[model samples]
Target: MAMRRFGVAIVLSVILMAAFAAGLSAAKRGISVGEWLSVPFSDASFAKRWGYGETNGARNVISADRAQQRNGKPTLRLDTNSGFDCWVYFPNTKDWDIDLSKAKVMRGYLRSENKNGWGGDPWIIFVDMAGRKARFDGLKQRLYDAINDWTEIVVPVGADLDAKCAEYGWKAQISPGFDWKHISCVQIHQDTDGSGYTMWYSGFEFIDYAGRTIKWWLSSINKPDLSVTYAEQVPQYKRYIASEPDPNYNIPELVGSAATEKHWPNEGEQIKYLVHIKNAGFARSKPTDFVCMIDGKVVKKASLPALAPHQVTTIVVNWKWKQGPYQFAASVDTKNKLDEITKKNNTLRFKTDAYVLVAVCEKSIVAPIEQVNNWYGSFCFEDWMRGATIDQLNSLFKRCKYDFAPNGAEVSVRLGKIFLVDELPDDGAKIGEIDKGLGLYIFDGVWHYPLRAIHEWCDLANDFDWALNHELSHQLGIIDDYQYDMGPDSNLVNHKAYDRGPGGIMGGGQVGDNVYPAYADVDIAGFNLTKGHRRGFFGEYLYCIPYKNTLVLSIDGRPLADKDIEIYQKSMYTGKIEAPPVFTGKTDAEGRFPLANRPVPKDFTTATGCTLHANPWGYPDVVGRNGLFLIRTQVDGKWYYGFIDIGRFVCEYARGHKDNAVYSVKLMPE
Candidate 1:
């Protein structure tokens, strides 16, 4: 009998091992087999001792002594009946302990003499770790229907449809997430099977990436362990295959956020805060709570609406605390209610310098200056901040992890008030016909702006709100982008790239509904002439703002002291020359005055009637809006005017005036 068995083993090995080399070639590419497949089950006493000898009929009886071996090698074999059911469990379930945390798939092989009843029920591989347990199921119905003699089986972790198990079977529901670490127990079992069959299963193991090795003992030889390769190419798994999907669709993440300015000089200044919220998910995120804490104390809270997949929203908050070092921490969905991929990123802690904001609202021109400062607008200041509503101007300083505009520089300004006055704060009184155009001035560290004058420029404002942003940029040390000939010898021109890419605030005096400096290729369009992007340069001087030019005054070769002087815009839309003072000042004891808002956008009277020009010409030699300008002032207790050419004087100033004597002008009798 032993001689005949050996001869039969040699013959069967040739037939069974025909495809062994093919499987080995695939194994070389990265594949593995389960160690349980090779573990001996050939001990006759072992199979009978374990109840494998049970039988209902001649053909449906278990292998009593050991079936024919292929090449004298042993394997687990079963001669099952049409209604057979059994399982081989380890010393309790812990004997199946193995770390599969990094594994990508669980694979094995199944072959049967009678394919009809072999896989009626799925071959279940149940795993458990710690107290958590989950089953890798679902393909039993599919496996029962498989026709091939050598069937490759694969069960991907985390991503597979769960089948409705029986009373003691696993519930059909989504697995929270795979606990691949410390897999303490596993069961290789079959339930409710059928029909006379002889089956064999061998070389199974958990595998990670493609090109991994199977720790199965038989891998020492060239025998192919094709479980991993077969798992991928098998058509039955095609529909169930996925890129390991997480049951939790999204993770509401709160990246770290901080104040636009980390340090400030004063204590009674508002500290800006930005809380970044993003949806790290494949689907839209539900409404979540955003919380702010200062030194472990809840300072602010806001409800963030649903965010699209990968969408981001920045919550701007302005809080005031005693000037000192305060740890600022913000978190999203702190209640731990949402099922996220990870909870680590739900909170972000930032150390910042917390201070209070000392801001006041002063309005004029019968305009509610309080409303302008308190009421919120679009962009940064959209609503009340912190415990109480703060100044609208104060909200612009909040910085977020993301820059709304790619090129928009993060400019952090000093904590200050948003002064709202009707007429440039103490303009004394409105003189003659006032033009709509307005200018911003800095005096004694206070920003002074005209109130009622904003209505006049309602027609000239490139954007209704762009003026504020443009001026704020200036205060942050940004230069004007307009191309202007400072003089005949010096024509200042800036980068053309920034000049056109994105329409920006500093680019032009444009005002009204507009976006930030997000450049795109398009023609400037506007409902009103001043509504769209203005053609101007960008970043001419990043850290430097247009400085106020100085004018030295003299009358008939003598110093003109305490003389009332104002810069006017004589260029009108009618292409005609007209005189209208836009800025006012007084000559100091040294007969000098600081001038700003030069070449103002004013209407002028030309031969073609009244054509509005962007800047004041004031001279025929410069071909500007006005033929000449009058520097009206009181000289020797009499009204005397200095006829000036705007462009010519600017050119002269650039070419000749390099010292404190910026523009030496002799007031002549007009």
Candidate 2:
């Protein structure tokens, strides 16, 4: 949002701060109304009462002879000889009469016009009854520069007024004995020696004033609303999770007992974590199962079947041991068994190492080629070839090693039809034939074609090398100076000097000397892809199954064909029980490992629900469903499956090597 500027007025009571009992009493009295005097400048009768000065260049001249209409409103034309040097006064003012010591805020409306005014020149002043004056220099006033319409000018009489006056040479004029009483007069003036000037003024007022005190406050129309709002009102499927494991076991230790430093065990590892989940569906969600895994192996899992509609939940998970470089993931299952909705409801992937460490990196960039084409298509080339010979044309092509049929294949030149020729030979072709082949004409030895032909021909890699480099230069908004005769029968050999000296390409005839396109630093930056720093995978393999509710792991989307997935099961809240039934099976040709009903202890109620984990060598770990009444496994350690709340199913793929596998899983409400 752009910043907006606003003006405010504040009123303060000096009597209350004076430390006098009587002063406090005076402050409680509030503001008092002053007299309103009308100074008529329109009626002919009032004009006659005051003697009028010179009708042409007098200051504050009241004329009854020249009144007119402006913008359908009655207006008085006040012409002044000197800039802002106009004032009106009472007929007889020999002594001060009105009191001003109890006045505060003053504001007014003004309109002015200058035939040759540069905008910031001085033009007005205000004077009090004591001969004290406040000068308003247009250059010093902070008025809006874009103000071509009528506007109100406000002047506060409190601390700001005193401060601004001192800073701009107005304080010295109001020193000791400066009596502000009887100062109910206004004046408008201008630079003494400027050109002719005219101005319009009207609508004046004084607001929020109590003797000498002023109060500042914002206008009722300019207040803003402050309220809380959601970052995104609509639900989404994205989820984010952060985790850390104890140093002793590491992230890799959660895969299985046989897990090496590079491939840790899935059981007995501890991890700490948090998860943020967003649901994109409109329907309210019920309790669901959640699971976490490291390197295609399940380390932790949980289940919650009561997530509300469009609600976001953050959950914390703690593991028992340290794990190294692994990916932490979570998901929600609408069904207790492996199915599509379960797979779509929950999932977030992140590198364990990235969470534990911070690093600086760069973004990617690309080039702009369209800008260069428009610049070169504005010139005519026909006149330059008006008197060229066939030999000269062939020689020019030979000099550039321009192959017309190097691969025994004829180049397709669309210019033949436009030039009214049937065909042209590859070499030793007549000048007219050459022109026809190029979709252009060669009168004598110079060749000429429509600008579109250059655009079409330049797109071809073999012939466009130099043409495009030259045309692209023009596209950069640069002008071309290559001269060509617009008239017929011009000499083909006689060329104009382009003045683009030395290695110049387009402008100068030395096209081959500098045949590369010119680019700014921004252009160069677009091609800098090396900044991303690619890393190589170390013995890592990926297994992905697109079907929902099915736990099938594969390498590059290919099932591990006959390879077994190992399964592990335990309580997420407390690790005090023996492993459940061992479920291991090999995958089909599609790399899918399917596991049906496994065993869940009948003795453990909701107080002792269990999670299932699966893992395959070289691939990451996978977690089955959580809060399960039964556990299942397939393809050995490669795939794991389980159910939550007895009906909701969930699964996960483990990631990370053995040495640094850390997994922290959280059980969140739907």
Candidate 3:
């Protein structure tokens, strides 16, 4: 799902502490005026319940004491003039520490100062003690379409919220181990256009459907005899067992895996996916068999335990994986064992990893190819190349087999078609471009350079070979990691989130000879193979310099120009400096400071400490803080700073390879 449709623009970053207290009891079986777990912003003191959260850039929020009168009611206000994003968090205060295990929905009221002035939907996040969060798109709740007055916002919590997360493609934001009982904090994030605007929020609460409203009472009484709803309510269970891509790919389950390191599933490995079955009916469900099928043949059938109303259970189905095309389907009650309402959702189809390649070249270039028959084979000379070319193409493509799996399992890449054309299409097609199914154009020189002038076909063959594999990767739906067309800037080549590691076909590896897809590249290709073309960031960052080796400073996505920078080692949690300035220097014309080959300290102590893993697969599935540092820079008479996680960058991304441990710091001005 496109996040823009939901209007959520903020990327939340905050570390919350733990909290626990007795919660209100659920009202017994009736829709009555029950006590609501709520935090009211009716007065300025509401600020005491909330704290300032993290932001990517400079943004500000006024203190709660500055509460303004809106619609004659005291409402808390936030202002953004920094042209950047920011957020505020409620850290599960003792007074508002309502247990969310029994909560059904989260409701609130919000208003904007100017009509239709909202930039995007605000995000409401629930973070548990373990840092696993349940983040939701607040657009639906905030009533974004019409936001003149105080609009009532409704957000489903628990299982209901999980379904909503899946529907909106927000499953990636949720970390594993998130539980309703351990909710430690709540954060509301917003976007800005640089032009200042005011947003007010009030009356935030978590309520239950069974105990709260008259609507719950009416629905209970008006039930149509036997109603049943079975579905994959959790986002984590919706797809094949693959790691979700990032707004922050640093999540441990993704980067800290063999799938990213050694690229597993070489010969024998198990392909796994989670199957969630929910009983959303009023009555309990009798035990039935859960059937799993591959290619329309039942492969696994297991007994399912009876489930109470609103209860959800997950079944793990796995098979020995091989490189090829496959179709997976699962059903809850294949034999119609449960006599209830409709069973339309009992079966579901899963995505598969399979691809075919088509190679084509122009006819005009064929004659020049025949003359060099001694050096090049006949298949390379023919107008519609055959024989040797097919075998070679298949070999090159099959090399991508290991990387093609989404998470080291389920993959296929086969050569499909080959042909020659009199003239390539001039529909804005660049040199070495491949259409989705249509074969790619194979010519050496630019459009202006005619094929008649090309005499040495064998010499151009190497470049053509590289282009062939590189373009084929694009046809499979992977994107280039490096940036282009930006003139005279050293930092223009890389992105801020460069964590995919160094050389790979999609990145720096293209400059070398034998090109193959990176582990990250293949993961993306596999995702597109099954998930279709959903909007997302795949290979998010360009390979920059090694961590702390060279500091490339940029502000507002532009090079900061010549400036002075200070570096220091600091505690990860508290910003307390553990050491004085390690190095101080002025940036060059491109805002780059060469650190004289100084490496970041590997033994520095971090807030969360560190764990050593022999290989990527052995790494724990939790993010840790090891070697964290502070970088302070001065640009245009103002100071800016940001933290760099050298320990994590090395452990997860670098993995002892300096070239793979690249990083660039972007500081926020004070």
Candidate 2 overall Cα lDDT vs. reference? 0.29
lDDT (Cα, tens digit) per residue for candidate 2, span 484-575: 10111221111111122222334422222222322211111111111111111110111121112334444434445665544443222231
lDDT of 1 by residue, 336-396 (tens): 5554422334654433421122222234422222111111110011111210121222233
Q: Whole-model Cα lDDT per candidate?
A: 0.36, 0.29, 0.42
Kindly provide the TM-score of model 3 when superposed on the true structure, using C-alpha atoms: 0.29
Q: Regarding lDDT, does 2 or 3 come out ahead?
A: 3
Lowest-scoring 10 consecutive residues by lDDT in candidate 1? 225-234
TM-score, each model? 0.22, 0.21, 0.29
Better-scoring candidate (lDDT), 1 or 2? 1
Q: Least accurate stretch of 10 residues (summed lDDT) in model 2?
A: 358-367
Q: Write the per-residue lDDT of candidate 3 for residues 91-184, one digit (tens) a residue.
A: 3121223357767766667766543355567777777655467777653434354255677666666666567555543332566778877565
Model 1: how far is 253 from its true place, Å?
67
Find the candidate with the highest TM-score and give its number. Answer: 3
